[model samples]
Target: MEQNPNKPKILCVKISSNQRFFILGKEDGFSVYSCTPKFSLLFCRKFQKTGISIIDILESSNIFALVGNSKDPNFTTNKVFLWDDLNQKSIMEIAFPTPISALKITTRFLFVLTKKKCFIVEIEKRSILKSFSINSPSDIKPSNSFDFSLVKRDSLHIAIPHKLRAKIFYTNITKPLVELTIKLNTPSYQLIKFNCKLTFLAVVSPSGKQLLLYDLLTGELYQKFRIANKVSKVYSMSFTQDDKIIALLFNNSIVRFCSIQLNETTNRLVKIENQMKNVYKKNLINIEDDTQGICEFNEWNDLLVIYLNGACYRFTFDEIEKKITDTVSFNYLNSKEVLESKFNFNIEKEDERKHKEGEETKTGITSDKLNENKNKKTNENIENELTDLVELLEEQKLEDNMEKEKGIF
Candidate 1:
């Protein structure tokens, strides 16, 4: 993509799965378009841009579907019609059990999590393979709402958090093969949880006051840390590639990096690891006042924080400084003349290097030619000497005095 200095500063905003598409439930007819990564529309509806319109935008995936709920009671059917990117045609509508609470797509399956249950459907066949219900633990009452994250490891694992307990189950099998029930130390059971590589499980308390790390394989608490402020809630948590640094986002504004160390001491039920050491913490960009949305870290390690004022900032983590730096360099060019001069200097240097290489190559060729000439001269001299020797032998063979001397004897 070409970067235009004059181009409007557009911070790519990712719509969460929880939010419905903007085009959905709109009174005024608005056109539906599939927004792709290339910023091109696959299809456009006839509706014009109205001030108030609902567009259901999928997070990360640019595919969007137009959903509308009619005023009539009998017209409550939620039909999800999506534009097929490959075919560039609208596909047949599929009936959803409930208004889709969340939608996730993988290579093999497209998962739609509704308020009632989660449905795993095959993308190619467009058929539901299995349906799983999200429920509370046996001891606890069934929860109406639960947060789940799909885990892809040796087998597909779904981590579901109900009230106080976070349970993990194998999604592929009809019956759950393994189940893990997490019991937190905090009183408020709301856990902001995420699973990393199906091995490392991290959970933050509701207030971001405490963090719990656990090993899913052994069902043991790996480490726990307590933050000072209880007002700051952790929106997201992630581990670096080395697993040494644990990055946490607070209220979608501040980002903190902590060093992770494992303790060797054995504990009774939970294995106590080394305390989480806060290495780096900073608010890369504050968007508390903005109504647009919060910031998130992309897969490219780019930090995208959007402000309510329609201003967006993209930053990358600087390893040396242990801080985030804006991707756009503000002071890229001081003056056009200076930039032109610098470019000309670079061109001149490259041309001079090429000219010097050419001179050296020409010198090498000349030296080779001189050596060849010397060898040719030496060969010519040797040939002349051989010719003289042959002439002398011929003259000696034509000797008439030897026969005359023999006759005198």
Candidate 2:
């Protein structure tokens, strides 16, 4: 079969647990980008040899965990390199007996997922701490199967998928034990995510139609939300930095959000029906082709949905005006032209507005000069009518006086 040209060539995109830096692994090399103001491309560096398949970087740090693809058998897929970007070289390389599948990096430990085992390695000591068996269907699965979070700036709060449930483990390297486990109603999970604060664990079922939010501490369900309709499919879901709002992309077209409030005093997520009340279903972007996409929330609570084809769409939500504006940019990865992501205009709506303004101007309604001339002509007509009325009154008075003077007396 011939390959579809529309297919995206980007291999993988990994966002740091901090949500500040995200790396794009292309067929050639991986480049890091900053999600600060606009999703700006920091720099691009291509490899002279093998392509990078996966990348996991520590939060806002130059250290990266890099994995190469197995297209060339000579370049073993069983190795993960600890790269120092500032020095521009690999400082350490860790090789496993089996090919590695996925990786999650942190300051304390590096979580490596392999064929049938999950290995935990100490970053400082460069020693393997433990290995556990996973009954995952395949050797390699989506890297989202597990997520890492920091507790009190030291402990590691890890969330992973068990048979059909979600497991939460807490360890500070001093004490390791099972903290809590969330009994899930869904048979399988598509992805699991922990908010940056490590307070909430968001789990989406395999169907991606429903969302479950759990209290990371108590392992209790805060509330379940309906993300999409039965027929619609949710491709991506993300939470804002404040954790007060969550957004999701549906049917590769529309994007919607729900309000979530975490009570600080109670240390619990509030339950509100406003989520269903704000169920807006508008096609934010009608893609020409079907594709899987991912969504991210920046510091300003703006929603950014990205596709593998380097197509990026941003929706800026203005709380004061209660309005949303969007902008689209293409070929973001390879192009040097920056994404003018200032969402000042909605393309179709802006065009329609200009057209309406043009029609109004043609009819002498919109132009200020045309309005001034129209008001001048109206004032002249009113003055002439007032003068004629005064003249009629004077003529009537003169006729009355002549009748009295010529009286038959």
Best by TM-score: 2
| Clash-forming residue pairs, model 1 | 21-55, 21-56, 22-54, 22-55, 22-56, 23-54, 23-55, 31-45, 290-308, 291-308
Error of 2 at 376 (Å): 80
Given candidate 2, what's the lDDT at residue 262?
80
Please give the CA lDDT of all the candidate structures. Answer: 0.41, 0.59
Candidate 1 whole-model C-alpha lDDT, 0 to 1: 0.41
Per-residue lDDT for 138-200 in model 2, tens only?
311456566655564347666655543334333334346546667666766666777756677
**In candidate 2, what residue range of length 10 has the lowest lDDT sum?**
340-349
Q: Write the per-residue lDDT of candidate 1 for residues 1-409, one digit (tens) a residue.
A: 2224562222222333321111222233322211111111122222222111223333323234444344433223344544322212233245776665445443334555555567766544568877766643332211212333443312445555433334433332323666666554554333343433445566665556677776766656778777536455554455554454566656546667765564324211245655655667765443462133333444344444433233344456765577766553111111121101000001112222211112211111112322233333322322242233233333432442244231111
Model 2 collision count: 0
